[model samples]
Target chain A: MITSGDHMNWKDNLIKIAPYVAGEQPDKRDFIKLNANENPYPPAPGVIKAIEDFRGADLKKYPDANARPLMKAIAEDLGVDADNVFVGNGSDDVLALSFRAFFNSDKPIVFPDITYSFYPVWCEMLGIPYRTLPVGEDFNINAGDYNCENGGVVIANPNAPTGIGRDLSFMREILDANPGSVVISDEAYVDFGGVSALPLLREYDNLIVIRTFSKSRSMAGMRIGFAVGGDTLISALRAAKDSYNSYPLDSVAIAAGCASVADRAYFESTLKKVMATRDRLTAELRAMGFEVPDSSTNFLFAHHKSRKAADIYDFLKSRDIYVRHFRKPERISDHLRITIGTDEETDRLTAALHEYLG
Target chain B: MITSGDHMNWKDNLIKIAPYVAGEQPDKRDFIKLNANENPYPPAPGVIKAIEDFRGADLKKYPDANARPLMKAIAEDLGVDADNVFVGNGSDDVLALSFRAFFNSDKPIVFPDITYSFYPVWCEMLGIPYRTLPVGEDFNINAGDYNCENGGVVIANPNAPTGIGRDLSFMREILDANPGSVVISDEAYVDFGGVSALPLLREYDNLIVIRTFSKSRSMAGMRIGFAVGGDTLISALRAAKDSYNSYPLDSVAIAAGCASVADRAYFESTLKKVMATRDRLTAELRAMGFEVPDSSTNFLFAHHKSRKAADIYDFLKSRDIYVRHFRKPERISDHLRITIGTDEETDRLTAALHEYLG
Candidate 1:
């Protein structure tokens, strides 16, 4: 008995929900492109070769719904059984599905207040009640804060924007406190520095670790991400994924992901290069009177003592250098998150900053 | 306070829901893949060229979130503005998003009982109530059946497994009767013969027409689908999509989609070839005493008077020829949905059938 007006009013839950705003992807290609934390190096040569060798006749058929080849590759690389893995379009898609499958409870879940912004958006969209636990003044997650009763817990290791990683023992504390609740350790940036909670999966049935190829593997445009956990947890995600979209990864992505995982030497060399650049860039910024954190990831979070964070961001942008600046959660309003790029790109960023400040 | 046992229990709704089962994609490479109704021809040469030309450096960066280039090409091809379009990973993803955005009302939506089996799966996953109206003895959707009060209406043009296309006037009648409901015309198979409801978008604000690159464009492995509608409906779908997953299509998919759409000559020639083969296949089946429907699609839905459908399906499979057979809804249980392959493939299928029945 609904009318036109009723149809126009989308689901009440969806109407008021605020969608997550991803980092801006400026149209101009000539810019330094450091805003979204993308890897400066191209993907491994094997990845490019895979796409080049793909046959047109293969595209005439649907991709394997299970993505068995990619799953097998990931399992072999991670030293886990195929049953322990689950893959999706990207970590965003994987996290969204996990929220639907595991986090729907009457009691609220708990997460760090200043973690990945997408966590709150997922809860809002799914109508799951949640409570945000504030991070310490140093912008580090306090494991004790998650000891209370809750439906589940999510933590992004090497937390974004802040770029600091917690020790594995700290993550174990959170998992031990909530033996029944599912504790998701998002290790998207784990390859850069942080000790992955992957080892904890052997002992904790409730631990689910999520990772992405956007950073270390240098395949962001291909859109591949995955989770590793106990067989039961992985099965629930599979059931949910099947009910939603059967073939989330296309054939091309599957091929590219397999090739990237197989070329271990290429991946190791690129990650080492990024880490070296990050250390050098951090020292240069601190010497320029910026309060740079002890970053464990490929990005540096810092603020100037005299210049406003927004001003520095604008100045950098004007010089064709992009960095992320957040306007809300007032505690971190003065901060700027600059992604670590190649040696040349990092040198250009430092030179630009020195000129602007002088 | 949720405890360990409480965490083990999933959402009440998801536990009882049965996920949709897609057409089988067997692991074997030698079989003639007619089960999923995929286009027999390879995608346009431009699609292959796009993949070949993609740079490894580009794969390191995140793809364009808005997919502007592909959107522009689709808009130009469809004679619509960019604001009127919304794209997704695949047509299945597009349909799932639409159900979440538009069909969460108190009243149950209506769809043909014998159409795409995925419709009910989407409803169950989203917790939306829906009723399936039975098709007529002729396997045609009676437009009058949709005159009742409901939240929405969904029709698959050149309906699956039946391959019957209703005229434009009948669709207009349904749209006229359901002025308050959102009428979704899924034109996944419309490129084969049916008149698209795209033209009606000018007159009806509540109409949404969905199209896919999987069918006529022969890019199923790329996973791209889109919808065209009034700006308001498109905005609602956008909100739902952004809330769920921001970037659904990968960069390679966007590039491949644009190339496929731009090659008009290749698209038309391939579609014409498919239609011609479909006609010949239908006549040959009828001559062999099979009850074949007047197909307006790339697939033929037929059944034999004396031979069992399951038997014929198995016989074909033994010879490496795969066709779809549905066992539910009781009405179409006897039918076999066979995708029209190339001329040589069609000859093989007919020859196989003759041997089995003889």
Candidate 2:
């Protein structure tokens, strides 16, 4: 009989998967963390008030399973009805549920070759067959590449590691072509000046637009994300979420998310600051001989003319200035993705780069 | 050729699932809210301080992907190594990931017929085939019934609704029989008085013990749950979680969980109070002609001798008293699962029952 000697065989049933590695969360308190695209500003004042006013005693009960309060807040903020919104722990959770709910066909789903790293990881984890269409030579997604028979299509607007945003016209073209496929517009960084697919939701019933508070609303620690689409599509995602975990959004998150969305003034103010810093840093990197793309999001993707990107990344780390570098697919291996931080952090990073390049 | 007229064809790929319906979360503030089996007492005093002292500014940063601090706290509380712990949004999340990680064989997994309804919902959602065995007439899980060729085994000790707990000797019998499969001992209610399968972890490498903060710890709103097992089993669960959502436990939850686990005195006090209330209520219920089961959990499972449970349920709800009643699996149709609330809430529930039954 099989015992401890063969206990390892029990793992044979679990399919082997290579998990997605998130950007490093460094331990040092003084490091300039410009790796993950988290918002540089603090959350809204209302959010802080909500946390302060929150009663610890009330946590004894289960939170609302539907997350109705947060969903209503998101829907109202987006100028949509409550039925059209679906909320989750984070956008990754939202995207994962969407994949399980919509991409169920035998045909291969399609996305850009250089997109969010987690996209392929989800496909591999869920056993969904996928094909990666290469981005254009200019680091832009060509709408024509997605006009084919497929199970689903996911486009990260202002596509990651490239920071190039697509227009509503480009999104409309893809939605028009894929009449039978569900198209997910992951607008994680859309608030940073990218064109959102939300406007096309009325014209395209197959479109699902996902947004995250981690970037714009400055609540990464609270883990709030929502998806907006037609009611039918939203119901499918809701069903998928309910089936997985009934109460993914805790009470504090619901309250914090509501407070963050209600404070539009603070939100817009932070967005302006992030974009200003991103634009200023773009010019600085260019003057330093780096070929930087025009970024619509909060980060810049670039490679130096004469220096190795990995070497620059290492040098930045040595100076406690961190940035992201992807070494996969070999196409964008030479590029470094730097998240826009506060003005002070940006200045520190600039000084570090000057010292390294000299 | 498919358009809005056939737009729902996209949903065809999605398997039609009957989502699990959690207990009613009534909007009114006055309801007793005993239907969900939540703790009546507030969380540890340290937990409140942790929340009040929390820095809202730090919310812009992502939480630790590994949840190392919370994991270490739980490990110390359980007297296990940190590597043997796996944490998630809740026990439901932990169990869902475990099902995905371990229950992969073609053989149908086994559980009791009158077990947690979410178990079957998970199997249906994941496409994992399962078989249900009937518990004995006394509502006790029969260990010999699980001694069969199966893909996996799941036993909710101090079983839900029935409130019957099996001994560790019984757990050993099942574990010894299933040397080739993973055994998940869901002790969601074990803190009250139930025997734990945690001791058997040293002997059975395939055994996993799942616990929740939603019950005795009084942090249901925080959404924290964990599993303790051999390092190999825990590693597989971690890989599955990292593949799904790298940060399921947000900042507030981690802080609250760590505080709650550290306050051993407060945790034990609440447990004793709940058990005392449960025991007193059991006697009062028996005197009122209800055959109350000997419960090891914080709830009582009882059925009236002459009163129909459905009518009694409605009558009590009309008076703003809440309790759980299962309609399916005819065996438990006549019974009601009443959570042990505070002494005052207990008095109110007993009075309501007396008013109706008499």
Candidate 3:
């Protein structure tokens, strides 16, 4: 009898690193699922129609290798040439490809210590050395910290967990400082009042602005994301993507993504609603003695003045509400990242908070 | 003016290799599309129903990171526990992750020279060294060639382009020889009358049998694929997948894939039709003075007695037909890989070939 271990220590030599632990996804829908920063609203009306009208027979063929129609729509939406776009399964896929495409020098790539946890995971997966500069005391990325020499730079514009947005000027400063390295502005949450570095592509050839349909477009389940960059950088990313997985986007995703991008009015309306809810939620949390950041995303990162974040998270979970609370890095261990739910859901959440705090 | 090249030769350090060129995905429906080896029939009836019944609102939330329902369905269909199954965006993604997961040692990995082109592309992308051993004049994998020391092994059963299937004994011989390395049997075309390595899983803990919906299940546009192996190997693949893209399989893909697997009758029926078309096409090609291989897959690999493969490919294209003709690796450059289409499509293709040959 041969145990799996009887084989060579394949796990030791294999790229065995800890995988990124995604937010808890409880099966039952009864919970106010604020854990994953998912959009509260459904996808655009056109997107729903596209899904409904999708031909079942079309699925027999492979999806467009170039994801051409979807690329055209995203290009039009971003006011960029289709040649400047690269689409993938999600921003994670896009970012992974970008890491492989641009970050290759012996120098360590740099990103914020407290940004999206997946950044370091990608770096580790690709065997790229990386250094994490700490964010400011306010939990915002210090642009000056990224001016140093590196293989590349990845910044989550409106950085995750902190819900803080950075200006185009900040992005420009980083790009200007690191002309030798590729700069990726992960604008996953940019649609929710966050300024995108997309317009800066004209000035910065090294900049790649990555966006996703998961949050603002309300199509997380469809798994669509893209990067808008200079034609050269986009070409490089495409080469890497092709080498990895030629058809990352499926037919359903491509069709629904096209419809979602085309319905600009619906996209904006949902973004506005989510922003309004987030603002309201921020004020309510502050009134309850929580120090909530001025969120540029649909979620608020807050720490209570008196109550513990872990306790609040536990209480919320017990009350059938699910908000994220990271215990790592210690600095933000007391903070709770609460995704903004619908107005009614917010009301229920506030009521529950009142019961716990009062 | 900073030219795109002025800043840095990021391309030099970054992964820059010729990407695997996928078969032509022509847009117009007028052509009798036979390239890319995609299924000629539509996805299963249950898959169509699942797509129709799919809820657009669910796109707001992320897909189940574990792909629980899809995993369960595939596991049940393969008569394996859920722990033995790992799902991904496609077999390309699965194979990519598997390469990163298993083929990591300094020793070079091994595969057949005339096998799937993407295997070497993946090795290049992952920075893994690999050597290709030549298949016999029969174009069948010689399992004896894989018994030596190596990092890992990857075999495409009913191997691509050639469409020749090896029996379980062939697989057993390779597995028995390579207890120290992770052996991957990419059974992408196995459902089309090819013997699966899945049964060998109980006997060989080091073996992984990768399967895809693109070929046999007729869901190429859905981008669904899985691997059945020992629990430990599946866990490693899942870890690698999570590290790369936590949600590689989207919600729609998961739901549709489950439905496709549930309808066993439809799955078997499509396979039978494709196999029948393939058999008929082989006989017809042989009669037309083409030397064709005995194919267990939904495609036929054939070379004309006198005409050049490139010329045949061009002639077929002129008649609004598409067949794959590889230019590189000179051994098979004279052969064309033709996918099995519907009976009507096949008749048209044969008629067009007759015109070209006669």
Candidate of highest lDDT = 2
Number of clashing pairs per prediction, in order = 0, 0, 0
Q: Candidate 3 - CAPRI tier?
A: medium
DockQ of 2: 0.67
Q: Model 2, range B1-358, lDDT digits (tens) per residue? A: 4455755567677647754566666668788878889999999999988888788888998998878899999999889999899889999999999998888889999999988888988898788999999998888888999877788999999899888888989999999888888999999999999999999999989899999999989989999999999987887888788778878989988988999999999999999999999999999999999998899998999899999888888998998988888888899999998999999999999999888876
Candidate 3: misplaced stretches above 4 Å? A1-12, A19-22, A27-29, B1-6, B9-12, B19-22
Specify the highest-DockQ model's number.
2
- Please write out the lDDT profile of model 2 over residues A122-199, one tens digit for every residue: 887777899999999988899998877789999999799899998999999999888888999999999999999998
What's model 3's lDDT at B45?
A: 82
In the predicted model 2, the residue pairs found to clash are none
Q: Write the per-residue lDDT of candidate 3 for residues B226-253, one digit (tens) a residue.
A: 8888877887887798888888989988
Candidate 2 stretches greater than 4 Å from native: A1-8, A19-22, B1-8, B19-22
Of the pair 1 and 2, which is ahead by lDDT? 2
What TM-score would each prediction reach against the true structure?
A: 0.96, 0.98, 0.97
In TM-score terms, which candidate is top?
2
